[model samples]
Target: MKKIFILSALAFSLAAVAQNQKQAMTKPKTTPNKAVVYQVFTRLFGNQNTTNKPWGTIEENGVGKFNDFTDLALKEIKDLGVTHIWYTGVPHHALVRDYTKFGISNDDPEVVKGRAGSPYAVKDYYNVNPDLAVDPAKRLEEFEALIARTHKAGLKVLIDIVPNHIARKYEGKTNPAGVRDFGADDDTSVEYKRDNNFYYIPGIPFQVPTSDTYKPLNGEKNPLIDGQFSENPAKWTGNGSRLARPDINDWYETVKINYGVRPDGSKDFPQLPEGFAAKEVKAHFEFWKDKDVPNSWVKFRDIALYWIEKGVDGFRYDMAEMVPYEFWSYMNSAIKAKNPNAFLMAEVYNPKEYRNYIHLGKMDYLYDKVETYDKLKEVIQGKTMPDPISDIQNGLADIEHHMLHFLDNHDEQRLASPEFAGTPEKGKPLMVVSATISTSPTMIYFGQEVGEPGKEDAGFGTHSRTSIFDYIGVPHHQRWMNGGKFDGGQLSQSEKDLRDFYKRLLNFTVSSPAVPSKFVDLQKVNREHMSYDAGLYSFARWSDKQKMIVVANFSWLKDSFFELRIPAELIAQWKLRDGNYVLHENLYGRRHALLKVVGGQGTATISIKPSESFVFTLAD
Candidate 1:
């Protein structure tokens, strides 16, 4: 009787395993929708005041509030085809604004960047910036409402997580139960400890940075602007400056966080396993689930989890490369364990560490600034040909999906600035290439669509890049704001045209099947033709359902008429026989071309105007 029961149980277990295998094999594979991230400086998005005052106070140049992002405003942004809204500078940072009555401590002007303060120098991780709220005490509640409103508008929320550093006067006023501020229990007598929150220079007093031409508030008088800060033992500056008195160029407003890495640059924490890079995020999480970690690591991990719990869809990690990858494996894995679909992007510039960060660190994306953005800038400025772009894309082919492409961001100069392309029209072709060339996410700054040149010298930040450190209004974006109407009622004809083009292009990019499909470079083959010049670039993207041929003219002063050829290999890949095919311009549907296919190869006469591009699709 026992043997018969054992046989029956074995048979039942085998049948269950077979059923599970069949279900797994028959599960439909779904492709992920590409993300279109709209990064807006939260403090500057809705300010309609056009007082272009240098070194202006908040009253002189109005400040945008959380309430400014009304339902109408969010709907307009969503209609622009944005999937995620990265609300930059949401965290409480060191600023000159006084909210002493609300029980918030004052930040010394000597350690603050501007009247509005640098968003990167975070003062409190547990709370939102008081300046963004209608009531100083209700800041967190207002921010939570914004998150809810963003979700109701069919968009995700993204905020900054500055893991590498924090403001020199780090304080968390709204800590959770039993939570403590960073460096609260550190032994300051030693320079390095495995669990110490910061690296210290024992017995050295902190000295404020000195600059001949620059001042904290442009020589404005304030009680805390005396160029004296109180720190008995100076900590290392955010930019890794070891001196007690950091240089003018150093990030003196913030102090670095130590994550188990000693002064000799060796990690005291546990390293990831040899094969962990290829492992899943859950596996990485399991690896660190029971292991002991440094106090700084746990603090950062808790901070990220806290934000995730607060309905933030993701984070944009600042200077992620400065922090160790193992900490990311721990922190990000913890985050993924909570929300598997969280969007994790980092600002890592080194090309060599791209794969490590993406795979081992479990980052969803990294900025493609150094290679793609810089090369595109060179091409737009007439400094280099677009030929190297194909190489750059191919070099990072294994990790292309992890690279986020953008023509403009807060750190880079605006596309319309004189230092950049000098006009918003020049960004048309570059935008096409940056958006459609890869399977990665695409980002655009707040004022990019309507062409804010960021030419104001607002306080500490100069022209070309929008000021994140001062109270100022974006003029061109304000035109679209139209005094809180959230409509483009006051936009000029040219500005309207530009915004229209962006809407069409971005909407098509997000919904097109061919965008995330396989790409074939046409620039290499087209280089042999006489009409195909360095100023022109072409490519093909095709899948089982859709096929597209993209061509762009980067020249600002020339038009191009070329015999765009499709090699026999690509024709065969598209399953085309010897016949004629009609290619319709999908951008505007205004132009169509006839492609003659003979002996499996295809050729068409294509004409493109300067700073114009087209995504030609095969007609049904």
Candidate 2:
């Protein structure tokens, strides 16, 4: 009788515990991910010229360093029609770890080619890159100011949040956090420990601007940090490559955001599965929960909150796919909960596979390359799309769900790169038409518009061209959608007009609704070409209240054409004047005209010019 009572009581206790855990695991609230994200590699995107000089350049000259967010620049981004701006690599790159070879330093650069590294190599967490921000307090304040301005202009802000890695370089002899040297023994509570078996000459960039950058303690920089800058370069370390993976995860947690996974595969914190008294599991969670805070995911949330507090709308996660989807879902949701209208996006090169993550509702967008390749191939092959525009339409739809759609990002070869296109100038048109009508949230990278020649070499082989601060081969004129080099009197008019033409198309996407809205549909025409009944490349979109048809000629030498026949049901619904189909068809000399015939088909006709994309739509 006693044994039976004990067993029954234990069962009841177990049930109670299970119910408590179930309640703790409430589904996280989320918002719809619908943002047109603009991804900017701050270093590459900005004006930093360090050509031929041995040292990094911080030009006090013209159009060089943007201390303040110019209305001209803001207007340019806004005019492009993007819903949000994702500024990447915003931390200070004042520390020139390289070019110490001959003697030149950051202060005396004869000319540093570009800006800083792609912003992924973070030297400090607190400040914006000086190359990008003229004044730390001022610039940050201005950045927030710009956020307010951008929103006023109908745009949002999304800065890059790198919770994964840090710059292999450092500024000042003092390591990050102002400690002499951090070791496991110095602070057992320290989540990461250096192996006694190894020695480390910590990476510390000498000139990280205090006014513009945060300073971490020693042993805190990434393994990739430039050891060459030190007296005994090789002696320093391989960005802590010797560090353990679990320790790496913990270090990343300290270094960035919510990265390290619980040893027992549970969430970090008071939130954990019941009965997790396992010593190792309990030990890992307890250590991180109490000791690790610098690189807390809450820290990432804090940074975002800081931006939002400062007035920038939000942030875009760099290489978001690498991080757990739950992290994004958490941060993104937290952000919206704080600001109902903030915009967020992720740079997952592909969106389909990441649906599980994206659909959970924190990532607002992703980078879409499917449309990129397909459109490029289409133009180059001179092939017409078949009915349903399956690839194009579906690609856009997927992006719409995740805020994808772009011409080029900082990580890959520029569409204008010869490897992708035959030459720089050849791929300009391909970039323009493809990105303009793409249903994904569209954005053009910094150098993409002008086809910056460094796309392939900028960050190739061993750690992407030394410094993003080194501005090499950036053009005088914007080369994004169209045009090329501009001389005083030579090719100036043509180049200017061509540039303006791209601007108009970009603006059209932003200002007009027909191109990106979900109402458009694709229809099968003939095997010769795929046709849309409405929107860009569409034959027509019709209903009782409105009618629209758009056609573009994507070929240079041939007269491209398509037809849309308005159905009799639609005509009856619209109550339009019934037209004799045969007469209109015969008179038009083309089967492509809306004609009310016996077949109840009012055929619509379309003709497109080489590389031309147009929209035709009418709605009440």
Candidate 3:
């Protein structure tokens, strides 16, 4: 009997110790910092104007008045608790082309016919258009001030940089090399086109692919000049004039840089589109002109570095895949080496290749295309909820290493379109999908949470019905993307509710990602409707020693009672006889007589309702 008594006493001691440990776990939390981010295209945010309208309709218009960039910043953004702001195409000079050769209407997509070209078709990277940058002289100060104000508001800034190519037509120089013509007439002769070996490709995209099209002007023998229309085959009396637009070469393509080959087989760097074509430039050796420099590319690295030093944290490298992966790695390291917290995001429109950017820490974030696309489809298409667990999980794995998580930004389809909204009733559920589930970092495009105002789709010649700019009387919206003015339609009360819903979720995500997992374990509460994405999810979090119970439910449907194993020791101490319950930290640690019943392992059952979720922190 004495020996039995001793054993019983020892058992009680261990239970008491376990209870103490459970209580001790609640030390306190400094709160986890959230990486939730927001992005936008500033020109599209404000008043519409006609003077800047390159298109006939508001949906196609994108140019905003230069001075409006600073005016659009409202108080709502800071209160939203986002850490980052991404602006699209700030410095793109308008190069609306006159494309009459295509035999399409000036208003047609084929004929640019003087419309605002995509900022990606930049004429110069250095200068901001006076129209966009109202006072060119004070532009830099204004930009700096904007950055300062953003930082003061507790947000970082991200600007887009298109490194692939520049606009040829908008530039003052008729030559593809962008050299000043200097009072030169439209002379298309051997002497006029090629001087000191300098020549540029013609307006035509693809006709002749060789330097053999080049011949020295006045028969001079310098390696510096090449000209467009080289295909004209100077004095090819051997045959008739082919009339093919000659493709002359230029120093920009041949000049080498700090990096290795220019990808175009010339010393010149940062030229031409990347990928398959760059490799093909190798087959025709005679087509390439050599200046006898071993191998060097343009000093684009220095330019990016200079930008980093000038108060920017990092860059969202446009077309990262077009550039060599090694260089991307080096650039990421370079920028971060300067500012440890710097983020270098990549722009990739593809969905399946999303994982590639995370390979070398080369990019802090590339939009999570799959998650956004799939979830949007599921919600908007009346299809069952998508089982995007794998996709979302893959995204989070990268975020563990500081990867950027997101929904929509400047490029591609807007998230607010029909692609994400099914019926007005499902809008809130869609918002939940966007803000929660996979637990990765999140981003929303500008005006996304607010609703997309109508604008004309210049590329497709259709109009987006969102016309908040028109409704709000934005002067800049009238100047640009809206072709001076527009109204996609009225904002529905449901849509407004959806926006508020997103704000709530955004605020929650920022706080929840920081939760300390004690006994919490997420489990599939039900697979019945889970495949259809119409089920509740239950997570079991327990403080074994605390002997408290926490039960939570997740779903966008009407239901009650989650099926879970209830631990007896935890149950004995507390009665979990109900549909839904939450376990606070204090309850998980406090001593109570009922806690005695919950020392043994078992399962607990809980319940949930539509669009509702729960969390339980069990204690002794």
How does residue 216 of candidate 3 score in lDDT? 29
Best by lDDT: 1
Ranking by TM-score: 1, 2, 3
lDDT score for residue 358 of model 2? 57
Best by TM-score: 1
TM-score of each model, in listed order: 0.94, 0.62, 0.59
Better of 2 and 3 by TM-score: 2
- lDDT of model 2 at position 444: 65
Could you tell me the TM-score of candidate 3? 0.59
- Lowest lDDT sum, 10 consecutive residues, model 1, at 1-10
The residue-by-residue lDDT of candidate 1 on 1-620, one tens digit each, is 00111122223244444343342212123343678999999999878888969888888998899999999999999999799999999999999988889989999989988889999999999998998998989999999999999999999999999999999999888899989899999999999998899999999999998988887798988988777899879999999999999998899999999999989998899989899999999999999999999999999899999999999999999999999999999999999999999999999999999999999999999999999999999999999999899899999989998999998888889999989988999988999899889989999998899998999989887799999999999989999999999788899988888888788777777877777878788998899988897799989887775678899999989978888999999999888878666665666655556566898889977877889887877722
Mind giving the per-residue lDDT tens digits that candidate 3 earns over 1-620?
00111112223344554455453334223343456667655555554533323233333343444344442243356456566776555553443323234221122111111234445544444444333444444555566666677666667777766544333322331222533321123233432231212122234332322434332222233232333322222221111122233233221111111233222434332322333223321221222223231121123444466556657666666665544444454455556656777766776656445544555324667755555545554534546534444345445553533334554455444445554442333344444444444344577766566455334433322333332111122232232223322222344555455455555556555554223222222333334433223443333322333322332222434555434555444344345443222233221222211112233534333433454333333433
* Segments of candidate 1 deviating more than 4 angstroms: 1-32
What's the C-alpha lDDT at position 585 in model 3? 28
Query: What are the lDDT scores of the predictions, listed in order?
Result: 0.88, 0.43, 0.41
lDDT of 2 at 498: 41
Instruction: Give Cα distance to truth, residue 216, candidate 3, Å.
Output: 36
Which 10 residues in a row give candidate 2 its minimum summed lDDT? 582-591
lDDT of 3 at 271: 27
